[model samples]
Target: MPERQDPFATLFDMQAEAMREMFGRFAGTVNDPAEADLGQWTEAAEQLRTMWLDFVQERMAGGGDPANPLDPAHWMQMAQGWARSAPFDPAAAQRMMADGMELWQNLAGAMLNTGGESAGEDDREKPALPRQDRRFSDPAWREHPAYLLLHQTYLMLADHFTRAAKEIDGVPEEQKGQLTLATQAMLDAMSPDNFIATNPAVLKRTVETSGQNLVKGMQHLIADLQRGQLTHTDAEAFTLGENLAATPGKVVHETPLYQLIQYNPATPDVLAVPLVIFPPWINRFYILDLTPAKSFIKWAVDQGLSVFVVSWKSADASTKDVVWDDYIRAQIDAIDHVRARLDVPAVHSIGYCVAGTTLAATLAILARRGEADKVASATFFTAQVDFEKAGELRSFIDGTQLEMIGKLSPDGYLDGRYMAATFNALRGKDLIWNYVVNNYLLGEDYPAFDLLHWNGDVTNLPAKWHGDYLRDLYRDNKLVVPDALEADGTPIDLARIETPAFVQAGRDDHIAPAESVWRTTRHFRGDTTFVLAGSGHIAGVVNPPAANKYQYWTGDSAAPSLEAFVEGAREHPGSWWPHWFEWLQQRDDARVPAKGKRKPGGRGDKVIEDAPGRYVKMR
Candidate 1:
C-alpha cells in the first residue's frame, strides 16, 4: 500500500470545513478576500471561550469524575432542548392530556374496586387488565394508581412528542433525523423502567433481596468501571470454537482481507451452483453460523447447498490502511475460489448488512466488465443501497462526530468496542441499562444467550475503508445514482444488475429500516422478490423455520412505495428462510453428488488452516 495519510490531519480538514460552514469563514487565518469581519470574529471567539469555561465550571460543581464529566442530568437537559425545539401539535398535546386524566381516573377506580380485603384463589388467578404496551404490564404496577398515572402520563407524552418531532416542517433531512433520534433517546432514557422508584419489578426485587441486589449491582458497576467500560456479556460462560462458532467447516482459502470457510456438506447431493456468503465485518461472521440450531451455514449445508463464507479479518494496525477495493477483491477472490473448487460456471451469492452493500457494488463492477454472469443469483439481507431514510443510525454520521472519532483514534483503525458502544446507545435501555440492573444492581448472572455472546465478539473497522463506506453509502448514497461510485477503475451502477434478485428486510429493524431495503427493488431491473420479515435485524435474519416464530410478508406485485407494498403484501406464517430457499431451488440447476474434497490448488490459492481460521481469533 502507498504511504498512509495522517487520519488526524484529514479529521482536522473535515472539522475546518464544518467550522467554515457554521461561521461563514475559516479560523486561524482568513483566506477569503470577499469578506472579512475581524471585530465580529473576536466577539465570537470570546463567547465560545466563555461557554467552554462555564461548561468546565458546571462539571467541577457536579463532582466531575474527569472520565465522565457530562452527568445524566446534563444529557437530560440537552434532550429537553432537542424536544422543545420540535414542532408543537396542540391537538395531539390536548388528546394526550385528556387520555392521561382518564388513565388516572381508571387507576383510582381499579384501586377502589380491589378494596382492603385479600383476594380469593380465583381472583388471584385472574389476569391483569389488558394493556397494548408490554412495558407497563405487571399486576403490582396495575394495582398502584400513582404508578399507573405516572406510567400512562409518560407514555402519552412520549407518543405525542414523537409525533410532534415527525411533524417538524421546513427542516433539512439531516436536522430532522437528529431531532427524531434526540426525541427517541430522551424517551428511552425517561422510561419508567429506568427508575427504581417507578419500576415496581426492580423495587420489589430490591426489597425482596433485602438490598443485596443493590450491593451486587454496585459490585458489577465497580468491576465494569475498573475495566474502563461496560460488560457486554458473561464472556466466561461461552468459548468461540466450542459453543459459539462450532459449525463444521474448513478454511479452503485465505487472504490478508478474508478467510473463506467452506462447510462440510450434510447431504450426498448438493445444488449444481455453489453458494457464497459475505457477512458484515463490523461483527464476527459467526452470527450466521452461531450454533447448530441457529446457524444458517449449517442449514444451507443440510439443504444440499455447498456453502462458502467470507470471514473478514478483524482490522488492526497492519490492516488499517486497507481500502474498500481490498474488501471487494476478497469477495471476488472468494467467489473464484468457490467456483474453482466446485467446478461450477456460476455461483449463488448472498450479502448481509454492510457486506450486502459491498456485494452490490462488486456486482456492479463485474456487470460493467461483462462478467455479471459469474453470480447466478443475488440476495441481500437487511441491506441498503439507497440510504435516503437509513433510520436513526444516520443521526450520528454527521461530519463533526466522524471527524472527532477519527482524531481521537490512537491507531489508524477505529475501535470496534467504541463502535459497539455507540450502537448500544441507540437502544440503551435494553442493551446497556438492562445489564446494568441485572448484573450490577441485582448481582445476577446474565443468562447464557448464544446471540448476546456472539454480539460481544466485535471487529474493528479499518479507518480508511470504514470512512469510505460511511461517506459513500450513508453520507453521499452514490450506489443508487448511476456512475457515482467507481470500483476497479470502472464506475459501477446498480441499474446494471439484472440478475435474479431476492431482497429481505426486517419489519422492526431500526438499523436498516425495511422501507430503505424496499427502495433497492427499484434499482434492480430484474425478477425481484422482496420479502418483509418480522422482528429486529439480527433475530429476523437468524430466524429458522423450526422456531415457529416471526411471520413474513410477500407481494405478487412490487408497489412503488413501501407503505403500498406492505398493505398489498400477503402474510406468511413462518420464517422467510424457507421462502428464500424455495425461490433459490428454482433458479439453481438440478442437484449433483457433492465433492468429497476441495479441489487441489483451489482457485489457484493456498489453503490456510481449517474453518474458523486464525484471523478470526485475532483480538
Candidate 2:
C-alpha cells in the first residue's frame, strides 16, 4: 500500500499543528492581554480533548469510554490484554502464552486494587494513592482521584512513548535520538501539570484565590511573551558586578570581540605563570566568577594563580561579520599580549565548553607555528574536542536543522534565546515545564537563584561563528581530523598539540558527555590528565573547594573507555577544585609577586573602567 511515516514524525507534526491553532486562538483574544477568560480555556481544552482523542483512537480504539475519550488508560489496558492473548510471540510459542496469561491476570488484579482506573471512570470523592514525581508531588495530586489518575496515566503514557521510541527498529542513531527527545517534549507538554484544568494544584489555587492567581498568571504570561522567553529566575534579583560576577578585577585588554579582565591577586605571591581562562562565547564569562563565594576565578586567584578572564561581547550587528578565524587570531593576540605585558614567557590556559574546542584549535595553530610553548599548560572544563560521543545535542544537528538555523538570524547572528531554548529542551521537565507549572500555572514567583539568573542572561552568536561550530565540530566531526579544519588559514590538528593538557568533565553532563571529553585524550598527543566530577555541566565546572558538595573521581589515564576509567577510579569526597589546584601546582609551583592593586589595563593605557566592565552590562 503506502509507505508508513515514522511514529515520532507523525506525532510531532500533530503536536506542532495543535500548538499553532491553540496559540492562534489564544493570541487572537489578547487585546487586553492580561484579561483572560475561562470560556476560551474551555474551548481550547475541548479542542485538546478532540485532538488527543483522535490521536489515541488511531492507535487503540474499541470500547468508547465517555468520561475521557482522550485517556490512554483504557486503550493501554486493551493493548495489554491483546498482547497477552496474541496468537504469535516474538519468541517461540512454547510457555509464552501461559506466561503472558499469568502476567495479564496479575496486572488486572493490581488494576482492580487501584480501583481499576483502566475503565476511564473513577470516584473523585475517595482518596487515591500518592504518586511520586516532582511535578505531581503536591498532596492534592495524590489525594484527589481525578488528579491522581490523571498524573499516573500521563506518567504511564510518557513511559510508553519513551520506550516505543527506543524500540523502533531501522531508524538511524541520530534520528532515533531526535525521536526520543521529540516524544519526551511532546509528552511533557501534554502533561496534566501543564494544563490548569488538569493540574489539581493549579485548580486548587485558583479556587482559593477566587481566580486571581490565573489573572496574575496571565499577566506573567503576557510579560514573558513580550520578552520572548520563559522567565526562569527572579530577574530583579541579581546584577553584574553588584552581587553577581562581583569578583575584584579590572579590564586589562579590550578587542571588538571580547574584553579581558585581570583580577587583583588575593595572595602576596602567585604562581610564576598567569592563568588565562577563555570562557564559551555562547554565554557571558562571569559564570567562572559568579560570586566571591561561588567564584572559580576567585578560588584560583586565592590559590596563588594570577587570574585573567576573557569576557566575550554578546554578538550583535557590530560583530555580526565575525568568523572563526578572527576568534583564533584574537585569542592568540591576547595570549601574546599577556606574555609581553607581564614579561612572562608563557601563561597557563583554560577553556570552558566551546571555548575549549577553539582553545585546542589555538594550541594546534601554535603547534603548527613551532611555538607550542606559548601555552605553559592547558585545562579544559566540560569541553569536548572529540564529538564522536558528544551528548544529546549532537543529534539535534543535521543538514535540515543546520540550514534552517543558518537563516534564523537576519542580523547575521543566532539569538541567544534560541540557544537557551535548545538547552532547556535537553532538560524540558526541569528547565521548562517546572517553570511553567510554578510561574505561570501556579502564579508563583521564580525563586532567586544566581546560577539560573546567569542562565537567563544569554548571549547571541555571530552567524559564521555559530554555523562553523555546528557544522565543523558537531555535524561534520572535523575537529579531531588532522587539517580537516582551519583557523586563520592554518589547517590545525588536535594531535599536533603536544602541550600538557588537563580535561575535567561532569559524569552527568548533558551538554558535553564525559565520554566525549575523555576521548580528547586520544586526539591530543600530550600528557593529558582526565578527571570526572559528580554533577552536570555548570555545577561540575563551577564547583568550589570550600562548598564540598559533589564528589569527583580520579583514575588511570590509560583507561580506554569511560566505563573502564570509572571502574578503576577512586571516588573522593568534595569538589574537584582541590585536585585541579594540586595539578596546577605540579606544573609551575615557582612563586612570583602578585599584581596587587595596580590599574587593570594594558601596558600603556591607565585603565579600562572597572571590573565586570561596560560590555557585561549590555543586553
Evaluate model 2: give its lDDT.
0.75
- Per-model TM values vs. the true structure: 0.80, 0.81
Best by TM-score: 2
Compose the digit string of candidate 2's lDDT tens values, residues 143-205. Answer: 333344456656655665676666666577777676667667767778878997666667667
Displacement of the residue 567 alpha carbon in candidate 1, Å: 4.3
Q: Cα RMSD for candidate 2? A: 11.7
Error of 2 at 282 (Å): 0.2
lDDT of 1: 0.74
lDDT of 1 by residue, 86-176 (tens): 6666777787777656654554445445531232433655444424466666554453444554566577778877776777786777777
> Could you tell me the lDDT of residue 299 within candidate 1?
84
Residue pairs in clash, model 1:
217-440, 217-441, 251-610, 251-611
lDDT over C-alpha atoms for residue 244 of model 2 = 92
The residue pairs that clash in candidate 2, if any, are none
